[model samples]
Each structure stands twice: as C-alpha cells, then as structure tokens.
Target: MKNSVFFVLVNILLCACGASANAPSEAEVFSSAHTTPNVLMIVIDDLGWSDVGYNQTTDLLETPNIDALAQQSLSFDNAYAGAANCAPSRAVLMSGQYGPRHGVYTVSPSARGNAKARKLIPIKNQRGLKTQVITMGEALKSAGYATGTFGKWHLGADPDKQGFDKNVAGSHQGMTFHYFSPYNLPNIKDGPKGEYLTDRLTTEVINWIKTPKDSPFFAYLPYYTVHTPLQAPEQVIEKYRKKGIKGEDAKYAAMVELMDTNVGRILTMLQAEGLSDDTLVIFTSDNGGYRTTSFPTPIRAGKGSYYEGGLRVPLLISWPGKIKPGLDHTPVINADFYPTLLTLGKAEQPNQALDGVDLTDLLLNQQAINSRDLFWHFPVYLQAHHARTDQGQDPLFRTRPGSAIRSGDWKLIQYFENNEFELYNLANDLAENNNLASQKPNKVAELKAKLKAWQQQTGADIPTELNPEYDADINQKMIDKILAKKTHH
Candidate 1:
C-alpha cells in the first residue's frame, strides 16, 4: 500500500475545502455576506427632483412606473432630504439622527410664522419620534426582518411604536384626511366601498408579499399619493388630461400616474413572490414638491425651503443582482437610510449616534463618493408655502431660522436671523442664483467653521431669544408683497 494511498487522498482534499468554505457567495447571497436581503422602502410624498421621469426634469411628469424603477436603479443624482419638510423629513428617515439628534426641527409649532413673524425662540419642536431612537424599524426588526409599515407614519404614534411588525395606515396623521374611503386611518381597515388609498396600500403590500414568510422583509411603502388635496383616479385624471396636462398640473399628474400604477403593482408582486432577486428596492422622496402644485424645475424652492428645491429628491436603489445599474452623483442624505439598511440587513447597529453614512459602499461599489459635508439643521419657522409661487427665504419665510452647508462645490447658508451667510457655487449655480457670500470670504470662513463644527456636533438648537412678538413692520410688509408677486412671475 502506498501509505494507504496517502491517507485517503488527504481526506478528499479536506472535504473539498470545507464545501468551498460553506458556500453562499454570489456576492454573499446578494450582499450582507451570508443570506440577508429584502427591504422594500418606497416613501414618495412631495416628490420632485424634477418629478421623476428619471430627471429629464419633466417632459410633463409621466413617471412611467417611476421611469421603470429609474431604469433598473442605482440612480442618486445628488439625493437629499432629511428635513426640508414632512415631519422633519420623516424624523430624519426614522432616526438615523439629525435635526439636532432628534428635536424634530419642524412640522409642529417650532414657532411656525407670525408671532409677528418670528424672530428667534424655537428649539421646542420634538412632536414625536424619540422613543430612544433605534428605529430603521427597530434595526430591521432586530435583523431577522419581516417588518411592515404601509404608508406615511409621520414619525410617531403607532408605526407599531416604531418598529412596525405591521402598521398599515401608519398614523400621527401627516396627511390622509381622505385619500378615499373613510380612510380614517390608524392600523387601517375599511376598503371595498370606493377603495383606492393608493390602491389599498398596494393591495396591502401584495398581500404582504404573499404571506407565508421565512424572515427577510421590512417592506415600508410610505406613499400618501403625492401628498395633499390633489385627488386622482378618474381614469388617471383622464390620463393627465390627455397629456396636454391642465390645472393643478392635471391633478398632480394624476397623483403621479396613480402612484405609478401602485409602483407597477409592487413590481408585479416582486416578480410574483420570487422576491425580485432577493429584494432591496428603496426609491425615495419625503420632501420638496408642493410649490403651487408642481415645480422643482431648476431647483429653486419647494416643500419647506432649505432650497435646492427643498433638498432635491428621487434616489432609487434596486439591488437586482446585488446593486449595479448605474448613475450615482453622491451627495446623499435622508440619514443615509439607517446605516444603509444596517449594512444591507446583516443588521444589529443601534446603540445611538449614527448621523448617516454607510451607503453600502455607495450602493455596492460604484463607490467614489468621498466629498462629504451635508448638514441642514432648520432651527424652525417654515411659513410661506405659496407666497406667490414660493421661491422662498423671502416671501415671508419658507425656512427662516436656518443652517445649511453642502461643502464640496460649496454651499453655506447660515441665517439664524441675519447672522447671515449665503454663498453658492453648487457647481455653477443650480439656480441658487449666485451670491458667493461676499465673493467667498475665505470660502465664507471655510463654510462658517464647517457650519460651526456641525452645530457643535449636533447639539444644534441655538435660536437665541428675541421674538418678543417681533413685528419689524409685519415682516417688511410680507416681504414687500411677496417681492411684488415674485416679480410678476
């Protein structure tokens, strides 16, 4: 015997290298490196970043199924919105933390306009979302997944107390005074007699991704049909009034083409429950859109102005074959979707402080991002929604007690009541109409000491007294009658 055939061929080559190191690597079973993937997340309210058609900036906003899910998805041409409106931008996208680590900077009375036009006296606004902040639906339901959520849980009171095992209408009521039916929301129910509250929350999440689960969910829709009294469904408002689009911009482009046919029926029920390449989805928008029925054109003002049309919008993400479709501009926000869905759901990450940045290698290695410095702080006072077609910061407030910042391609802002700042350069002004803060005073003291050391590392709330019913001649006669009706439009 040749040494018993060399010990049985070295135990069959060590059990085939331990079964190829215990398999599972097609990008680690669709990323998170060992079987963890499924996180829908839609959002869409006050949509803009040029009302989606993959940003051809509006060939009259058709949004063919969110432009076919932004052409397979990776999209992110400078996304942003973690406070520019809608309940502190859904409480900084469910507390990855911002707005001074959760004071919720707006959508409650943080002195919103006319205490003789508020001069300072704000920092109070924490209307909800502070159950000790660990929610990206409770860290993806403690990482085994299977969560729910449906639509618009404007940061409080029953998103099943912030983790969402299932909370269909999702309350704290941000808007749904009537999308149809006595959608008298809260844990939702009534449907049948004139159904259609975004087609019954997209058939109740495609019957909860066709039930019968085995861990891996976190759905979260968040659509309140393109927000506000702009009804639709009269054959999709006569197909946007036959695309000649009329009034209220054809009922908000027929409620964004009926919420893009309920997002192509949950992308055909995640490809009939095969869970579309182990799912990842995303898509976005919680702010910016509602500047008199439609206008994010040239990014000037909308939603509740921190500008760049209320912090731009549309984000996409997809994850079909482990994230790779294309187009990435970087400037992300929305508290970077809770450490980018807890690093794609391999989860477990919340013992506080996560100001956002694990965009999962900017959505799986298209990575080049680098140039950071985002910050937005809104100390309060929002007002001006349609001040003669809102291009605010003038027509009597659309963000007054401020704080901005951008940093690479420089932005600046400031303004906690005329301690003023302004600067611009968003790579040749995306209509911030050039100020360059007195021609860049050392780039405005280097972005005002990096926006004052990020408002002293996010303790932020500095509105300094004053507002003893401050009038200043009725805020300069309503900012000179809305700058003479926005200079005759």
Candidate 2:
C-alpha cells in the first residue's frame, strides 16, 4: 500500500535471472507417509477470465498446460476476486473478511480522482495490514505448517514478521520497478544480468519445494507476473508478434504465456516430487486485467470497473485423490479461501470475527453454496482508464464510492454518491447489460434493504462528507474532454 508516489532505481544490476538453472524433469520421487494435505495457493496478479484457455479458448492466446490442469481440476464457472483492484483483494483473501473489517478499500488513499471531479471525501485507507489481525500465513504456521511466501506481498515489509518461514521476494512495495533485476524492491536481492523476475521467482519456488521438510508446507506463490511494467523474453515476445499481436497486447500476452510456463514448472515439480496428490493447488488471480494491456469480452470493462469483467476471475482447485475434477458454478470470492483452507488443513479458527464461511464442504465434496450472499465494499473513487471506451456508469470514474452484493441470481450495486441502485438478474443477463432496478421495484427494494442492513451490521463506511473543492462544471469539462477525444478518434 504505497501512500505516496513510489520510486525505483533507474539502473538494473544486470544479472542472469535463471537460464542456467536445472530444467524441469519428469522424475517422480517418493516418501514414507503423508500426514496432512499441503496447500499450494497460486495467486496470479491481474489476470482475467478470458486470458486463459480454461475460461475462454482462443487461438489468440495459448495456455495449454493451464487448460490441461483445468481438465483435472474443479474449475469454477462463477469465481470472483475479493475486490475490483489489487491490494484490497489480497487483504480480503488474507483476512477472510470484507473491506469494512480490514479497511483496505484500495491501494493508498481512496480519493483517486481529481478533487474537483469527486463529490465525496473518501474514507481514509490503511497503508498496511495491522498486527492485531491474524494473517493466513500466521494461522497456518501456528498449525505446524512450513509457510513460505515467494512473490509480491504488497501489505508490508518483512512477511517473516507476519509468520512466514521463508520469503524470497516480498515486502511493502506493491509492484516491482520493471520485471527485471535491480527491481529496487525491498527485501529482494538482484540476480545475474538479464534475469527475468518471473523465471527467478519460479526457480525459487522449485528450490523451496525440493527441500525435504517434516511438516506439510503452505506454498503461497503470489506471482508478480501478468502485472504492469510488462517485460518478457525477446523470443516469447516475437512469438506472439508473429501471430499478428502487436503493441501492449503482444507484450502482455508474452508475459502471460511466460507466467503459464512458470506455473507449469511448479506443477511438474509437485508431480515429480510425489507431492501432487497430497497438495491442494488453489489457482486464481487478484483481480481482472488492466484496461491498457488486454481485456476479454462478454464481461464489462477491465480491472478498475466493478462489472463482471473486473470482479469475475478464473478459479481452479486440484487435489488428486481428495477432490473431484470438473466444472462447478458455485459463486465464490477471495475471502472464502482463508476459512476454507483453515478448515481443510485442520487448523484452529481465529478468535476474531470473520465474514466468510468455511468452504471445505464445497472444496472437497463439490457442494454448492447458493444461499449465502457474497459482497464487495469500495467506498472510494477509481478513475476510468478510457472514459469513452471503458464500461462505467459515469464518465469520470470506473466506479464511484459504492457497495455491491450478489445473492442467488440477482446482483445489486448501490452508489453512495447519488444513492442510486443498479440491479441485474444474472441468470438472464450475465453481462449486466440490463439494469432491472427501475423495472422491478420490488426486487430492487428487497436486495437494497438486504445490502443496507448488511452494511450496517458489518459497520461498512459510507463516504458522505462533501469534497469542498468539488465542482460540477469541472467534472463535466473532464467528461467532455474524453467525449471530444473519442469523436476525433
């Protein structure tokens, strides 16, 4: 959570990332006995549903290994990230509660848009995870598990302080300077010249798993790949460019392919080490793709937007002998992972209050959770990427200060700025192309009442203080500038 503008070292140390490292092998090793299930939660950064073959197949992108893994996994049809952006989503996943509990609505201060364009003064955001709250690593470490976090941590400096035994590259910084050496990242040392950050991190994981340990390990591989400052191998970039992909699309696709390659490496290592069957591999992303790089269709706008495109993400859970393999449409969010993993690992539940329910039943037995309503609270303003092209309610921002909930087939969103509600029956309109709030007043009332009650119960903050500098004329002028740009294009 960077409260101020982040700075990075301009010069890279120039080191080999991991080209000479031992190539992956198909050799399978064995052990005497398996006591408990190991957890391998792979949280990829800023990936969308349509980016992978499992969610939406296209020759435009190739993710054969992930697709194969999906075939052997219980893939979710309606999976969601905790928040519409990065840090808050990770916070929700780690804490197992909504924004109200953790107060990490977005990275840094929540008031993102220009002051004149904003109507309300956003709720102040916490820059780091508090020590009072129990983290996932801390909970699992207490349960006698060897916990290691190998990539971007974002929350704070030194995950070791938060109960991790081994942290290869994790700290207070959110994104690396560039995806290369001399990253200017805190707590991570630079490798050899021309080393790719993704490959280096993958090698680190491989080495970690190779070490024979007594307790079942919790490998939290939160890759910084598929994120910004997009950098990849020249050959990989050339491969996608040959397919008619160019500019940001090609660079982004190359990085995605590289990420999938590294993921395949990890999966292969588990199988080779005879750890596949006993390990539960949970795969998902923090949120959707950034609007600038790549965005898949049928869902609405990209990452910052609150529509399905930003919230809905790809989720896959695979445990060879324990869980079944197939598709499941049980609606789920990132918070569910904390309680679900605690229960599955036979760990003690924390004393503090948790908003998510234990989902071990759903994970192992394929049971559906259709009754509980999943919610998201973002009492902040997120400016739109491209007001003309980006799918957002108003032109100023992708999402204004708002709270949203999805219960069964209906999903309702309440924007605090205008006290306006937008309702959609997802069963019929998955894209949320139609707003049924005006049409079905009764349905709107029912869901709105529930949302309001839940907010009060959770002590959710609603931004009400007017931004004294707010000017309607200035906001309209900004909107007009975008409109004018679009017309010219």
Candidate 3:
C-alpha cells in the first residue's frame, strides 16, 4: 500500500505538469492462468444513468451495444460512486472502504508520497490513504493474477508503482485533453495517429488479453470518455448533428455514442478471444455525468454535490454462467466490489480492516443482505475543475464538510461544519427533492448517532499539517530530483 502512493504521486505530477520526458516503461507481463477468474473492470468517467440506453431516458441517445451488454449483466439500480466526485471516490473504490477510512476525504491536487519528504513539515493535513491499505490490484497480484491498468489512472497516477503489471495511457488528470492523440504532461505516449482515446484504450486491452499468459488477468480499464472536453470525432458529432441536434447537446450526445461504440469493441474482443464466459466484466462510472449535458431529473444534484445525481452511478456486472441477468435494487455501495470480487475469484483477503461486503452470494443466489449501511464523507470541495459549482460560495468561499449515512430507504446527509442536515426516504423519494429530516426528527437523531459512531470508528479528520505543508519535503524532493536531472544534462 505504501508503494501505491508513489505511483499515484508520479501520475499526479505527470497529469499536473505533463508526463515525464523519459518515463519508465511498463513492467514485465506476468502469467494469468494461475489465478481463478480474469477480471475486466471498465470504469467510465462522469457518465450519467440517462446517458445509457439501459436506463431508459427520453433523450433518445442510443447505446445499443452497451444496452446489449447490460441485458446479460446484473444491473444495479441504486449503485453510487463512493464520493460525490472522482479522486476521493476512486480512493474509496480502490481501498474498498470509505474515503475517511483512507484519509482521502477529497481530491488533493497536491497530495504527496515520498518518505524523505514526509519527514519534513508533513504532507498536508488532509488525510491520505496510508500505504498500509490494500488495493484490489495488490491483492490479486498476491494471488498470482496479472494486473494491468489502462486509461485514466487517477488514483495518484503511476499504475505500475501501485501494482499493475502493465499500464498504458493513464494519468492524474481526469481526462486527456487530446482524444485522437492523447498525452500526459508526465509520460507522454502519443497514440497512433488519428486513433481516438476510447478506441485506443480498448485496443490496448485486447492486446493485453492476447498476451500468452497462464495466470488470470485483472484488466482495470478506466475509460476517459464522456467526461470532459466533450470532444468526439467529427463523424460521430455529425452522426447526431444530422439528426437535428446542435451545440452543447449534440457534442455531448456524440461523446456518449462514441463511448458506447468503444465499449462494444471491448465486448467484441472478449467474445472473439473466447474469454467472455470465463471473465467477469464489471461496467460502472466513477460518478454521475455533468448536469449540463446529462439529465438526472429523477435524482437531484449533479457531480460535486451531495445529492443523488453526484454520487448515483450506473453499475453492471456480467459473469456468464455465474450471475443471472436481472435488475437488483440491492443497495450495495462501491466498497462492496472489493470483497465481492475476492469472493467471486476465491482469493484470500489480507489481515486488515475492510468495509465492503462480498455481494457475490447476493448476485448469484438472489439472497438478501438484510440491513447494511453505506456511508460517504466529503471534507471539502477544492477547485472543482470538471463539474460546475451551482452557486456562489458561502461567506467563507468554501463548502462545509459533510457526511452521509444510508441504510435501506433512509438516508441522512449532514454538513458537519455548518450543522445542516437533510434526510430522505429513497424508496419513497428518489429525486431527494424533499427533506424529511424535520418531519422525522427521531430518525434524523438516530442516523446522526450512527454517522458519528462510524466517524469515531474510522477516525477521519483533517490533520493539523494539511493547511501549512505546501513546501513539504516530498514536494521538495520532487523539485530536487527535477533540478538534479537538469544539471546532469
């Protein structure tokens, strides 16, 4: 886990400043047959439920290929991105716990990793995911799986440093600015000329699968599609433009169409390679799509906000001959994926704390979990670049820290710093437009206590150094390394 941060830091630095001029090559490929089942996790960025045809929106944005894939998948109707936004959500997703547990409560553009630097003023007071935490890749690798990550490696950036055997074209930046020929500031690998980013990523996956390996493979393809810069090929945009759409809506629609097409290509490769039946393909987005381009009408709030739209994301799992195809309102959170995958693959978990439950039995046996609570903590919203801020900030120019506790139909959203709260019965009100807290004071109190207890258990708090460590030793080492290289030249 400590090594994970180095990779993340490298990637973040690359995304923040561009890829390294001479970034190291991917590590040697490992065999995959020794592992139980190969896993392909396709995570789309900022995609909305309405964007996919399976979700049934009136917008008529067709996603035939994705829809077909979903038909055979265990669709999750109430899945959520662990956090309202990306980085923090990914921290939770990777650690199989809430962000607070990992000390990654929110996205930190300046998060650190080097130990020599850690000895100095310290790495920001903001909680970081400790090296002690376990990641899905590390766990699988320990179990003899070949893990490869392609596209958008935003959990600190360096996938190889984290645990991947092979990594191609991922960075800390949310999405590559150039779709056709993508490059990060840190490790710029130019894509084949005219090759779109989405198609290129899928191509890399297909190639990885073709590698002659004996161990099971874990391919984490976090697509940078349908996120931002909303650029698609002219042909794609024209395909929708000729259909009577224009401006922002048309561009957004084109991006969605392209995203679906690329996903289909991956599915086609799986079928062609005869790996579909043996592989477990999980498709989900990090968070809801941007509100301006996508509609989450039935669900209030969009990305960066605590409302359903920000956190609610589409989830589908397809393990042929394993999971039965159908919709399940079984309220499982992102953390559930951790244990669920381990259980499904029959892999051993490390001796450590894990917040996610294995939902494999639920998916395969049609069993119920009875009652389980899902939690989310967002300490701050710092410089949100991808999503829009709905209004001018409060007098403090910052949003307050907030936490949520959800069990069954009841959900309580609490803003800790401001002492504001909202409660909703999702079974009755999916939009979350009505605040039931005032009407259900007792329920609010009960949930507040639960949320507080969980916080105590997790021990999540902004450390004293988070505010003052701009020139911390870690960043200094990064600077010194850069300068030393220049002087040597």
Estimated TM-score for each candidate? 0.34, 0.91, 0.81
| lDDT of model 1 at position 249 | 87
Query: What does the lDDT read for residue 213 in candidate 3?
Result: 92
Q: After superposing candidate 2, which stretches have Cα over 4 Å from the reference?
A: 1-35
**Model 1 agreement with the true structure over 1-489: per-residue lDDT tens digits:** 222343355456656666566654434433433246788889888887788777855577777887887888888878889877888888888888888888887778878767887877877788878787878888889888889989888778887877888878887888886888877877788887777799889888889878988888889898887888888767878877787888788888888878887899899878776677778888888888878877877879888888788887888888675676778877889898888789778888889998878878757655575677989888878787678778776877788888998977778888888798888888889889888788769989988998899899888978888888888898899788768867877
In what order do the candidates fall by TM-score, top score first?
Answer: 2, 3, 1
Could you tell which candidate, 1 or 3, scores higher by TM-score? 3
Residue-wise lDDT of candidate 2 within 315-380, one digit each (tens)?
998876456678888888888888888877778999777787776666665556647888999999
Q: lDDT: which candidate is best?
A: 2
Which stretches of candidate 1 lie above 4 Å from their native place? 1-35, 45-91, 102-246, 276-285, 288-291, 294-302, 305-344, 348-377, 380-383, 387-395, 398-458, 465-471, 476-489
1 or 2: which has the higher TM-score? 2
| All candidates: CA RMSD (Å) | 20.0, 11.6, 16.0
Which one wins on TM-score? 2
> What's each prediction's clash count?
0, 6, 28
